[model samples]
Target: MHLNDLSSCSSFTRRSFLRSASAVLAVGPILTEAHFARAAALDAAVPEFSMKGIHLDANENPLGPSEAARKAIADIIPNGGRYAPPLYFDLMKLYAEQMGVPVDHVQVYDGSSAPLHFTVLSFTSPTRSFVCANPTYEAGQRAAEIAKAPIHAVSLAKDYSHDVRVMAKADPNAGLIYICNPNNPTGTITSKEDIDWLVANKPASAVILVDEAYIHLSDATSAIDHVKAGKDVVILRTFSKIYGMAGIRCGFAIGRPDLLKKLMDYGNSPMPITGMIAAQASLMDSDLVTARKKLIADTRNDAFAWLRANNYSFIPSQTNCFMIDVKRPGPQIRNLMAQDGVHIGRSWPIWPNYVRVTVGLPSEMQAFKTSFKKAMDTPAAAFNEMPPLRSRRDGVVV
Candidate 1:
């Protein structure tokens, strides 16, 4: 009758047996891979966000996990009860092989955010500040706050790319320099040459952190090659972006084994086997990367075309999200759009009038254009209602 009472009962009845069997055959999968793309953890509080609102705020692949990944998840669901160390190591080996490095060079995480935080905790402090672009990914910056390290947020250059030279000059005693390639919100990129220069010019003691979370969406080469060349760079990669594993949570920290050890100092635990299996399946699908890249590019181009025709200003993007100037206060515009049942993203403090919009499906983006037009004209709409500050999914927060 009750959860506690069930534990006390020694008798086996049809109700109990069916309940037990149902838990395994149904609820077990629900508790894991069933809601892979849903932000179930965050929406528990703001239930409305989980509704039919068209969400273009976060940079998520509307084309969720690949067919291979779905199959792998289905195949692995029965084995969910076990934790196989060798299989986990096999994933590491697979990733390492792709990078053309020893398995020791790669370390996996639930997502790139964990290692990104642990890294700041690993190497930054009050004496050694964290240097990053003013509008870069905020996870590392938040981690720097917890570490009590000074934050030196250098503004983006004329091209809307990381001003690596200025960032290098921001704080000579910097412990970590974060570069989000195909930068978030803007989705612009810093050239490999500029990054190479930053690697060569930065203080010898400082470690450069390259976030390639969106690299696969762009034409850029990953900085993991720099790591292979024995540079003091820790490269972060995630299946969350292009691979559509935002809720599934699989990513990596690529560096020399010694550099990865620093992150491990904070904590290390076995990864969710579901995530690992899905990642392996995603990786093994040779065509997954190219096919998805084209889909995102096409969708992004269409959004840009609409923006140009509507006379709205926006930066050229290489990844799946882009910033658009709303002319009105961003939170005001975002809230009005939410009223239209289209949940958009928040603007950064630095650019109060600009909001980030992830490239969604063709139909969703079409809905966005209509709702966006109406929201822009609704002068009487309340402007003070901002979205939540945290979400279970990446790119949910500023």
Candidate 2:
């Protein structure tokens, strides 16, 4: 059915659903040209990106949700027909208590992407520009485009961390300054001291957006405390990465109650009952974070060792994904790997020759190693048939 059909669903209006759908297209999967090809291939009768491949493109946990979360989802299946607000309350309360914040300071969503987009729409406009690291996640930048908010993309520092001082001075009329800790693509981190400095030094009218999507995989301190201290900051958390709930879709936006209220100006929706229950179960599992962190780190470290042994250059990552300098166009390498039934992640426009690789199961990573070696071995002349790279006005892939 078309998106307009969503209007018939209770509580879903044409405008709200369209806004949400647009947000997904802007920030969700189908990012680069390669990703667009993969998306189209998925809808094709003879898919190019085979369903049976060792898929590690997205930064998703291959282990799936925790057992407790699985049981919680199963138990809540019967109540799927109900719009259970109580479950949302329970999950919110549990999350707030664990984070040591007031329940009112948290707002749950289907995924952090929605709030991420809405926050940009709420705060940014033609007069107030959006500021962010150049090679970081592009969802907010896309949203800023829709808002007609000018974008100021500061380049990453020499160590691949966000250049926070430069970002703070990017635009005096800045609406939002986005910092994705353990940043996407590179998987490197900006220190909390830099984040603190940015918070204190950013334009007076701007609010800082700190995305902690991969925080569980790293040893970084969260910016949630800034929220509790009533700073003009919003911290985004997702169960998609470490919790293995990407497909299930549960995330949170933590900020002062007033700051969160501004996000509601654009759109809001009821939390999915399954996501709520699973999130609560996941949060209550005390050992889940530590256990999964070590599992991912071990797998990632083994892959790094193999890369080192092979003399391949890669960014030392603290998250579940890392970027490797492929020594050729990233899309060409990605397509070659796809032909070999190994779907990997895409590259950013700023770094056309490097591709991101998500850490998967050990067996999957082994498959990745084999395919990567083969792709690398293939002659650069073999990629002559592939289309040349194209860039949008803002330097993002179209």
Candidate 3:
């Protein structure tokens, strides 16, 4: 609330990162690669819970947007009737300025997801492959599948860091290597040295796409400096995380101007003006990151401590989300918790035993701890490794 509330911070820029291309170009290649359980989760017939409980399914920031961002949105709404084309330019400039990079080096999107999907499409093809960690965010892998490009799902090392050296060797002809720092689902960090090694050893024509959607919550420094150094990296930044702008949906794809232009070729519509204005305001508020980080850090650390005391194993995390090993199928635990009016996140196919949990307000976390204890205390039905294939296979194609 107060300007003094924030922690010390700096303008985050891409000295380096990595990039993906387009969604359309990626579809045809991956149509057949399907997971039966994931397919069922995406089914239209799947019951939609009206979010009537503590919703932590997505890695959403419970803090929401800052007060400055809310004010900016309200002030800009009257002008929203007009095209306000210049707002796009203004937003990009503010992003570049904060990044200490040129305006051309940055491109804004409705949310980072657009560019995340697009980047895989733009750079990957049937001949070139897309590579990423096995239990990492699968959006990029889906994009690669769509592009009809081969996907190399490398496993994370024992310590949960992306096995960068192994990842570098994943596919000699890989067009894109995606790294989500503080990786989604797990919220574990891949080190800078590993990232540096990846950039150094990766195929020259290939690009490294870094998704820093949760960077601020962690202690790791931004790899944007490599982008600043003109490395073949495109970093994705989303206001959805620390800025609490998930609903507002503003995100950035920062890279060399040439790398970004490739994404434009696939085409995009005008951005939401309120999102642009709010994002700018969020950026200008120096204390926002610091304050939000402390709030999330305190909640997350406390929850981890509780899990440790109870002897429930969890992945060490630096972001707002972390995975808890519930000693059973994650989906079963997730559903049981949901029945108690406490919802959590889905499990990755690789780590079927671990369920992801998003950090929430202190009160919400307390609810989660209580609900989890009950969920775990009850005897769970045994789980099967291969779930029955979804009857509606048609829905899985996309």
TM-score of each: 0.85, 0.88, 0.87
Ranking by lDDT: 2, 3, 1
Query: Which candidate's lDDT is highest?
Result: 2
Clashes of 2: 0
lDDT of 2 by residue, 1-398 (tens): 23344333323122333333233223222123234334423321124444587777778788889999999999989989997655756677688889998777887888788788878887898999999997988778877888899999999999999999999889999999999998987889999999999999999999999999999999988988799999999999999889999888899999887787677655566678889999999999999999999999999999999999999999999999999999776777877777778888877778878888999999999999999999999887787765553433333342
lDDT of 2: 0.81
Q: Candidate 2 regions off by >4 Å?
A: 1-50, 385-398
Which 10-residue span in candidate 3 carries the lowest summed lDDT? 9-18
After superposition, the stretches of candidate 3 with alpha carbons farther than 4 Å from their true spots are: 1-46, 381-398
Q: Rate the local accuracy (lDDT) of all candidates.
A: 0.77, 0.81, 0.78
Per residue, candidate 3 scores C-alpha lDDT tens digits across 4-53 of 32222122212111122222332332221123233434432235546477
Per-candidate alpha-carbon RMSD to the true structure: 10.7, 6.4, 7.0
